[model samples]
Target: MNTAEVLVESLEREGVECVFGIPGEETEALLFALRDSEVTFVPTRHEQGAAFMADVHGRLTGTAGVCLSTLGPGATNLLTGVADANLDKAPLVAITGQGGLERLHKESHQALDVVDMFEPVTKWNAQISDPDIVHESVRKAFKVAEYEKPGATHVELPEDVASEECDVRPLDRRERVRRPDPDEPSIDAVRELLADADRPICIAGNGAVRTDASAALRALASDYDLPVAATYMGKGAVSDADDHSLLTLDSGDHEEASDAIQSADLVVTVGYDIAEHDPADWNPSGETTIVHLDSDPAEVYEHYNPDVEVVADIAAAVRELNACCADLDAEFETDWYDDVRDHIVADVTPEINAGDPFTHRGVVTVLRDAMADDDVLVSDVGTHKMVIAQNFRTFEPNTCIVSNGLASMGISVPGGLAADLAVDSNVVAATGDGGFMMNAAEIETATRLDCGYTILLFRDDEYRLIADEQTDHRGEHFGTEFSNPDFQTFAESFGIEAYRPDGWDELRDDLEAAVESDEMAVVEVVLG
Candidate 1:
């Protein structure tokens, strides 16, 4: 079989249903190979959209989402999304077509050191110069990308090597890799720590949202009477509908959430990644004893020194802790956290008023109510992301997708496309003016693919997130404002139905209709 054919076979072995990217001259052989396989190749408007699609796909499926690109500019455009996946801990494999090896050493058209450029952002990356290793390389790519603490991995295939004839067969799919479980001593230490603390609080991170992990955590919280506060990326790690939920744990102008953390005697961080919330913000005094549980070891920092660490499969670790809960009838007083929970509930709870302006928090509240428990809402990076994290209530894990690692601005639109492709439930892409305009061209791609999802576009004609930051620091902001076209016309031009909802009544009605429909739609809300 040809090298490209072997690569496609390897991809098939990984159970890759779709590969996203634009077809280019260098990827001609690879494209033809995909054409002959069962894998559907989605061509997006831009390389960044392809990577974002793969990023969300991986986030939903726990498999490595695959994206392809040609050399140079295409690969560069693909960088932001790849970096997003890497930091967000979503498994993704990005494949790039390189120019012929013979001309790669010397500067040539579209021949840049893509492998080198991708090294900093990827977990692992390599270029395959030998046609014989195509199967091995592809297999390695998937393995590394899907490993624990998963992130992006890269595979570079030169055009000449892709076109070469080869006899090597694609590698047989190996058994699923199992993450290591924590030892008895580690579990014992965690049990002891939990038993001693009277006002212990648990912080859930993105890693804690796996179906099994969430189940275990809920049981642990219920049995031990622990309040779970989710990091922004960790929203829905514990359902907001649950009584033990603290809604969201963040540091900012919100005194209630911060006060809750400050009063916490012991912080049990499960699947926590410091990237989502800095340790210093929560542990400014450096006095609270911390318990770390995750797939990876605790990241070393001045503010984050764990008294006990149980590093293993996060679900398994929590399950072990739950089993230990039987040893002690740990009944920490829950009354202290009640006001914190009440404040959060009242904060996100929307009040419809005729005189009120369209607020970001209100949009999130209405949208959350409109969505089903299993539905997915992808939040693009912006001020609205902060609002959603603080106010949006998600009942299930991965239901609310936020790009916090790289926290790229233009992810929501393309992310919605991936979320739709990954799940049977309804998908929504929440974006503000700046973020919407960045990847708005993907409306055409979604329409072309016949993907059904809603684009919840909020327009304020400015980069209000940055503007808000400037207002905090310098007391004024500049160059953070921008303009926009009528998003209704923009979506309609792409052959999709669009709605500009006037008020709360229209917005709630529009949201229900858009989500229930089987065709792509847009609901544009002006946040003036």
Candidate 2:
């Protein structure tokens, strides 16, 4: 058997169903091996799109999503999406093909230090120089990528190594590794802290979503009458429909939620990561008593000092907290935050008047209402991202995907494809004009794969997000405006259905039609 075949077998053993990437000369051996394997290699128009697809796939599934790329530019192009997955805590295994070993000592075509290039953005990375070590390297990549605080990992297989014959077999898949339970002392400390506090709130972060601790988190908050606020990446940690749900806290527009967090004497941060939302914004004085509950220890920051920490499986930790708190007879006050929740609800509630031009809030409201409660919504980075983060309400964890950590543009199209592949529900990819153009070519990929999803393009013909920031920080906007092509025509040319909604009434109908169809479609909505 060839080394590439052994690698493919190992990937299959890891339960990888699909690998996304654009094939090139260096990747020829790996692609040929995959042809016979059960794992399907999804060929995308660009390596970046492939990486984005893998990123979303990992975000939706706990397993590591795989993406392949050739040497040099192919490897570099995958960097942004790989970094996004890393910062966003999505499990991803990035495989890159390298030049033959003989040429490593000198300059060669499409050859560079790929392992080193991937080092900054990956949890772990290695070059497979020996055919005998292929299985171990592949296994380790998947293992590290799927471990706690999941992120990106890399494996570079040189052309000669991939073609070399090897008498090796894939290792048996290991049983699930059990996570340690939170210490009884830590649990007791948390219980004591909550019992003495009157106004306590929970700040849910990306870790909560990744660990699938939403139900347990919601239970803890609901049982204790504690209001729950999520970061942008943690949008659906608790159902926004819940009475105690503060929606999201990243936009800084939810004044009531912000106020509640600032006034709270005890802050219970469940699976919270400082990267998703800064503690300085809420606890500037570093005085609020914090109970940090996560799989990993807290990161040191001036404003974030944990009074108590429960380092364990996130779901288990939250459940234990709820169990311990259930025994307490002390009454906790939530009237203050309950009012805050009301204000948040009112703030996001859209006003759609007849014949009015479409507003960001109005479009979001229509889309949210149109999608099933469990359907997925992928928000590309731009002004629309902020609007979606603020207005979109996801009923389930991972139902809403936003690139808040890496905050990369052009992820929505490929991300929606991954989401659709992962789930049976309808998926929506929402992007602003500037962001949509980044991976617009992926429409052809969607058509070829028969992946049905809606691409909602919010056209303002400018980099509105940066323009708005420029306006806010400076006296004027510059280098942020640009012209856009006819998106409807552009999409249709790719053999995908396209729509241009003249008004809200037309938009709702078009969106419904797109969602109900089995073919990929794009809807261009001009923002007011």
What's the distance in Å from true for residue 381, model 2? 0.2
Error of 1 at 177 (Å): 1.7
TM-scores across all candidates? 0.98, 0.98
Compared to the true structure, candidate 1 yields what TM-score? Answer: 0.98
Candidate 2: Cα lDDT at 449: 85
In terms of lDDT, which candidate is strongest? 2
Worst 10 residues of 2 by lDDT: 250-259
Can you tell me which runs of candidate 1 are displaced by over 4 Å?
251-253
- What does the lDDT come to for candidate 2? 0.89
Judge candidate 2 at residue 487 and give its lDDT.
Answer: 80
Q: Model 2 compared with the native: what TM-score?
A: 0.98
For model 2, state the Cα shift of residue 86 in Å.
0.7
Compose the digit string of candidate 2's lDDT tens values, residues 130-195: 999998999899888988889999999999999999888998778546568899999989888978
Q: Which stretches of model 2 miss by more than 4 angstroms?
A: 250-254
